[model samples]
Target chain A: MPQIFRRSANSYARLSLLGALLLAGGLIGLIMAIGSSSYVTRANEFIEQPIQFSHLHHVGDDGIDCRYCHTSVESSPFAGIPPTKTCMNCHSQIWATAPFLEPVRSSFRDDRPLRWIRVHDLPDFVYFNHSIHVKKGMGCETCHGRIDEMPLVLQQNSLQMQWCLECHRAPEQFVRPRSEVFTMGYRPAVPQSVLGPQLVKEYGIQSLTSCSTCHR
Target chain B: MRPNQNSQFRNSQLPRGLGRWSFGRWECAAILLCVLAAGCRQDMHDAPRYDPLEASPFFRDGRSARSLVTNTVARGGLREDDHLYQGKVDGQLTDTFPMPVTAELLARGRERFNVFCAPCHGRTGQGNGMVVQRGFRAPPSYHEQRLRNAPAGYFFDVMTNGFGAMSDYAAQVPVADRWAISAYIRALQLSQRATVDDVPVDRRPELDQAPEVRLPPGRPETPPAPEAR
Candidate 1:
């Protein structure tokens, strides 16, 4: 009777071990399906913009002032998108016939504002004041990642807080002023004439490595 | 040095345990997420406090503060000729008069005008004042048809309530002083339109003398074409 009981106990132990192995294997397969080797589709996968404004055009051709398009940058916290009226002031005579410009023309006719979809998004906790940056000489290009070259206005940088603070901590390594900020390659402009050092002198921006600075 | 058999098993066990952790990655992650979820506790009842005294003048009515100063200066002014809209309250603590526009009060008015109005409206009451030199577009000339034709009471309204871009002087300039400024502005309009017949015979001589700008004439090298361009 004892020998028979031991044989039965051993069989039961084997079945339990096999059950455990199967559960573990199933869990591993689930993890691999959801988490293992995560992939990111390239920014090229998406294309949904109203006007399809070529950043390459204005920033390259007309030499229009950045402030002319983004007038509120020096005054408001936002680097404000220009109003429809602002576009109509010039486009009423220039590109009055373009199909993409219909939305802009409609807004002007309706006396309504344009609801532009923001291409880049940042967490709300980050308090970024464009006025101080613009006033102190931070350029459009330093953080925007060669925007003048993009056809459909894809976000060049991740714009994650860490990415911002990395430059904010060591601005001399990354930041450049108006003309230089928009450049595609490493801008070898003079140091004091550039934005990174001038902002330090003008406003004395403290180290951004601290969480309190951006988080607040 | 070669380890004993028991010690070798122990060493192998250590490696195997570490391997087990990596092999069972979902278990490790699930435990980590559970721990993180347990740690997150928030209390959301704390509210920030603010003091009313620290509120800006725009929020707190600043007119009351200016009225305090106005009451003290209101005693000596043109006691008549001002049809001020006073329902019952007479410039915060005084009841004797709403605004006194006496000759003595007009002198104070002239003094206050030079202090405030002359910067925007010239000493001669033309809108081409010193502020216009500082790149501010001058207001239309006070003697212009529109402003000249405007009522005396309407001029007082502008000083008290302020026209566009100009901040209301109701807080800075006293109400009686505002009346004084209106009287002086009217005096200017009358001066421009006053004829010899309009002026009393005794005061006609001075009123007839046309004012002239004294400029150092540059004797131009060749000066025959005298038709004013």
Candidate 2:
């Protein structure tokens, strides 16, 4: 009778252990698969690009247009990646030298999008609309830093919430006309007393610049 | 599960009573394990049956509570201030547009009423909503004499600003919706009044129709015959 009871106890203990192990393994797998997308590559730091395309030689030295590569900087929220066709517009005839040509060739052959490393990533809470900033005469370099000058683009300023708040704190200081949005060195055209008072009265813009405007 | 009782059960063992018909050590261990397994229960009523606003941080304060100062939120409780814009923010209560008593508006008002008002004021506007059923004080009926005589503006003010235990619905209900609800309240008041002669233009929205109001028992609107003088 004692032997029967001990066998029952040991069997139940083994079953419980197996159940706990399965539960723990399932939980760990769920966390990992959810945390990292299997189909997409994610990187926190600089990723090796398909081509070591020199923004230094093209945009910096030659003073080429940024829109020449980035097709939708002005219109779209995403300053979209230049399609392989776009890269081929120049590189098709002149693929002479750009070491990382293998990744670009692979992208064209496999129909895979070039996974450009994001230098700047904003937190989920802060909603910084690119359209408004782009329309309000702020240039790409204002927030993104000297992207036109960097060879391998890296984040210049800490894109912290406080950093964005500092500008929103006083829009009168940085904001300019929509035409001058891409003008890197441009400042607000008019003084606060000269234009701010007039615009405030005309637009009937109430002070909605509260915490809920951004937080909620 | 707490181990205190299980430890006590284990300690209660006294050599299995040292005689016949006594339980063995394994039986004692089994009983102790069984005691530990039966001690975990959570309350189901934690979800609270009442309206969430009644339990909001602002109204539950025993003493005067200063709500966080924001442009949107009017500071003191509605009646606390001089019955105006609460004076903290730069706005007027009457700056809102007048709500037209259309059928569409009434339907919307009723939907809003159920979502918001039905918690405190019943679906029939009898002040016997679920909260009242759960032992809360019922809000006054819309057909009350004082409220019936009250202007649409007054109802809008009360709804937006709140009165007594009620908190401001300004945040919960929009300005246009507040006026629409006021118009609906007036309709309810008119329904209970029973006579068309006493109904104002704003209250007599459904005068051409029956099935509205339905007229209590025997009180029907009878026009007096014209006498030759």
Chain A structural similarity (TM-score) per candidate? 0.69, 0.62
lDDT score for residue B152 of model 2: 64
Q: Candidates' DockQ values?
A: 0.03, 0.01
Judge candidate 2 at residue B172 and give its lDDT: 50
Off by over 4 Å in 1: A1-47, A177-186, A191-203, B1-229
TM-score of 2: 0.34
Tens-digit lDDT string for candidate 1 (A1-216): 124356688889999999999999998898655432222212232346667777666554433445545655666777767657656544654566878799999988975556555665454555678876665546676666556566667666656554687777776555444334323433443343364566566555555677776667
Q: In CAPRI terms, where does candidate 2 land? A: incorrect
Best by lDDT: 1
Clashing residue pairs in candidate 2 are A50-A100, A137-A181
TM-scores for every candidate against the unseen true structure: 0.40, 0.34
Clashing pairs in 1: A141-A181, B77-B100, B77-B102, B78-B100, B78-B101, B78-B102, B79-B100, B79-B101
Give all candidates' CA lDDT scores. Answer: 0.59, 0.56
